[model samples]
Target: MKTEEVMSYYAHTKIEFNDMFTHRVPATINGMVHHSSTGCCSFVFPLSGQGYFTFDNVRYKLMPGMVLHINNTADIDMKPIGSEGCHYAVIYYDVEETVIAHDPFVISIDDYTTCQRAVEQMMKAFTTPGNISRVQTKAYFMQFISEMLVAHQRSKHVDREDAMSEALAFMRQYYQSGLTVTEVAERFNIERRRFAHLFERYTGINPSNYLIELRIQHAKELMRATDETIASIAEKVGYDDPFYFSRIFKKYTGKAPTAYRQCL
Candidate 1:
């Protein structure tokens, strides 16, 4: 919060928790005595006290009731915020399990009680060596990460909505001008692959499919509003081939252009 440097840390991840344990870092020490490492990731949860990570030359604050992710792909610096030192739980996981997730470097515990509970449970499981079961341990770790992913996705939905609406508006205006999904994405300066992903995430429809629906809807309006020829209507709606347009229209509406017009 209140920091731009903190956001850059969220850009990288292969998150799947490992080498986890509870460490009550003393106030006498600054931060973790971390040396250079490779192919690793760190997650921090403060049980008490406060701390922050210096990532990408920017400091991101961390406190109790929150989680932080520090990817090992780059150099990272972490420090406790106050002299009281920090009592926190940390997970040093290296293996990246294949999972569909949104990477949010920081998570607030307030809105996600399930994740908060998962952290506490995992901490206890890791510390209570004799009481740990392999199945239960894996279950807790997976559950915590799963909840975190859910929280991250939920948090971003609002921000994604504005972009989705703009994409829809662009499609509505340009559907008749022979626009493609890739072109629509380029107008927003987003790559085609990512644009399609986010577009579907927000609208539940692929960008290309949405454009097709728009074109068909416009063609229907033309058929109803005026006595336009099928070929002319097809051309006006961005289809140069009347036969192809008719096929597409029938595929979507289950009626040929003439039959649809007769229905009206």
Candidate 2:
């Protein structure tokens, strides 16, 4: 599912904390299956070691940076894959029947330190013997979820911006290599159309237009600095045919390459 959908689901759903516990499994343990038949959903947070959880036939790799939400009726199978035992915390909660999960999912978080602190507070409150501790436990659990969601959103935004910066750098480096929108997008493993859309959104111009503008800009620089022929200049800027390059140069600058160079 998309990140937006996951964030929306959590934002709209109502939940009440029931209880929480910590589990430690040996490294040699394998093929251990646990089913949640107690009519309560669970949020699993791994603190250390590595493992895998298979729920509803979907396998999720478990590590320090991931959190999983499983519905009450899921058949969860756990296996430790690290050299040491897996140490994790599980928070059980009840959601409104109308908002109950139809499919379990995993969330990847880059910042786990804050989550660890929240879970530790929840664990302390859960073990305390008082009505006030119960309330505190729920508050801490809610805060943890809220922080996780916000962090996910923030990290995603930063990632998109970083990817855009990298894409721009890639274009600048390869602009003279006869690069196409499709070729540049393929370098980043993005779909051609989506890549074009994102590039335009980030740069205020489509990839093809940006490439042309970039090549022309460099061509103008070369025209001023060198005595190369128009055809040679065209090839240097990634265009094979000088006549085609002249037409484009005219379109962008209202003058042919030779005329533009003479003015330069």
Candidate 3:
């Protein structure tokens, strides 16, 4: 499927959310399936039956109440576990940047019972005939997004304490200045090697790489909203050399700055 087609699906899908839209798909599994367009990251909960979702060539079995996250850049392939097809509910939405900045990529909810209840409520709201107006549908979708975020945060595996707090504060303040790992470690009064290890342990990425991602993320916002030149945007994001900035931006976002701006 083309990107436009996928977007159209999101637009036309009978979804209901308070602040966002919710898409409920009932799918049958048999042969191999491929989603051509890069799908958005989403939550999938099995309401009945069983299936397996293959992502990036890894297959995960889906049982009742099982919530699976599919990456935005991945193509998902689903296969039924038994002869009977699986029935599932999928919810997709984009949270605020602040929320995403604080959350990890993958969050697993261990409390299946609570998740099942939430799914049932969402299904009830979705299937009720003439009960949801356009505004009500949109509101329910936003509510669903909020519920998913709450559940994911509650079940997050890693716990961050002193170091994580300091790291996040430091990033928010200095992300635009091209701060190095050594500088951050020095500020924390720790050895460079030890700081690297701790940062990775807490945040799941090395300090330097995280800073780079932060810068790129900010640069993307600038690109989308500003008419600034590519060189100027690079400088604002801490890169003085436009060539190197362009290369890194392409590597991160799969397009040159000009191309990205044009698309927007």
Candidate 4:
């Protein structure tokens, strides 16, 4: 699911902290253990060691820098992945199901040190003895949720920017190989329309137009440097039909290929 949807769900849903505890287990699981199904959602934050959780038969690896959320829907099994045991904090919270349904999800935290600090503070508050400490613990839990969601959003933004940069570089390098925008998007495993939208937002032009610009610019360079036929130049720049290439050339440069070459 998109980060926006998760943020939206949190924005509209009421979340109340129920309980929290740190669990330490041996390096092996003797048998399957069932997670609490008390109608509250659980968030698992690993502190040390490596393990994996099987939520209704679907497995998810767990370690530091990863946050896992399990709704009250499936039995969860935990097993260590290595010789070392696992230490993790599990926080349970009740969400307003009427506002938005919850699902199991695992998200990686970029600033994991800060997240660990927040978890430590929340646990401290939870263990303190007082009515005020209870309120403070709940407050810390909400702050933790808000910070995690915001941090994830920021991480995703940086990731998208980097991915778009890589995509642009790939397009510029392979533009003359009969490359299509759809093919480029598929190469990066991005959805077609979403890739176009992001490409346009990043480069101030859609990927298709950017590709056309690349081919047209290279064609102009070939015309200036080599005395090749328009058809040959068209093939060099990834166009099959010289007439079709000329039409697109004129559309972009305001002159036909032969006319543009004459001036060059």
Pitting candidate 2 against candidate 3, the one with the higher lDDT is 2
Per-candidate clashes come to: 1, 0, 14, 0
TM-score of each: 0.43, 0.58, 0.39, 0.58
Residue-wise C-alpha lDDT for candidate 3, range 1-264, written one tens digit per residue: 222333344445443332212222344433765543233456666666556667777776655424565544566676754434566666654432212211112233435556666656655665666755544544555555446545544433324357566666766665555556775664444568987888898889888888889888889999888888998898778687989999998898899878888888
Would you list the clashing residue pairs of candidate 4? none
Query: 236, model 1: CA deviation in Å?
Result: 70
Task: Point out where model 4 deviates above 4 Å.
Answer: 98-102, 159-264
TM-score of 3: 0.39
* Candidate 1 global lDDT: 0.67
Task: Provide the overall lDDT of each model, using Cα atoms, as 2-decimal numbers.
Answer: 0.67, 0.78, 0.59, 0.78
Residue-level lDDT of model 4, residues 1-264, one tens digit each, is 566777898887788999988888777578655565666788889888766778767877666656888886656678764446788888888876833334577765556677778888999999999999998998889888887876676555556677689778877765665667876665454678999998889889999998999999999999999999999898878787899999999999999998898887
TM-score of 4: 0.58
Per-residue lDDT tens digits for candidate 1, residues 157-221, read 43556767877986786576566786666445456899899999899999988988998999999
Better of 1 and 4 by lDDT: 4
What does the lDDT read for residue 210 in candidate 4? Answer: 89
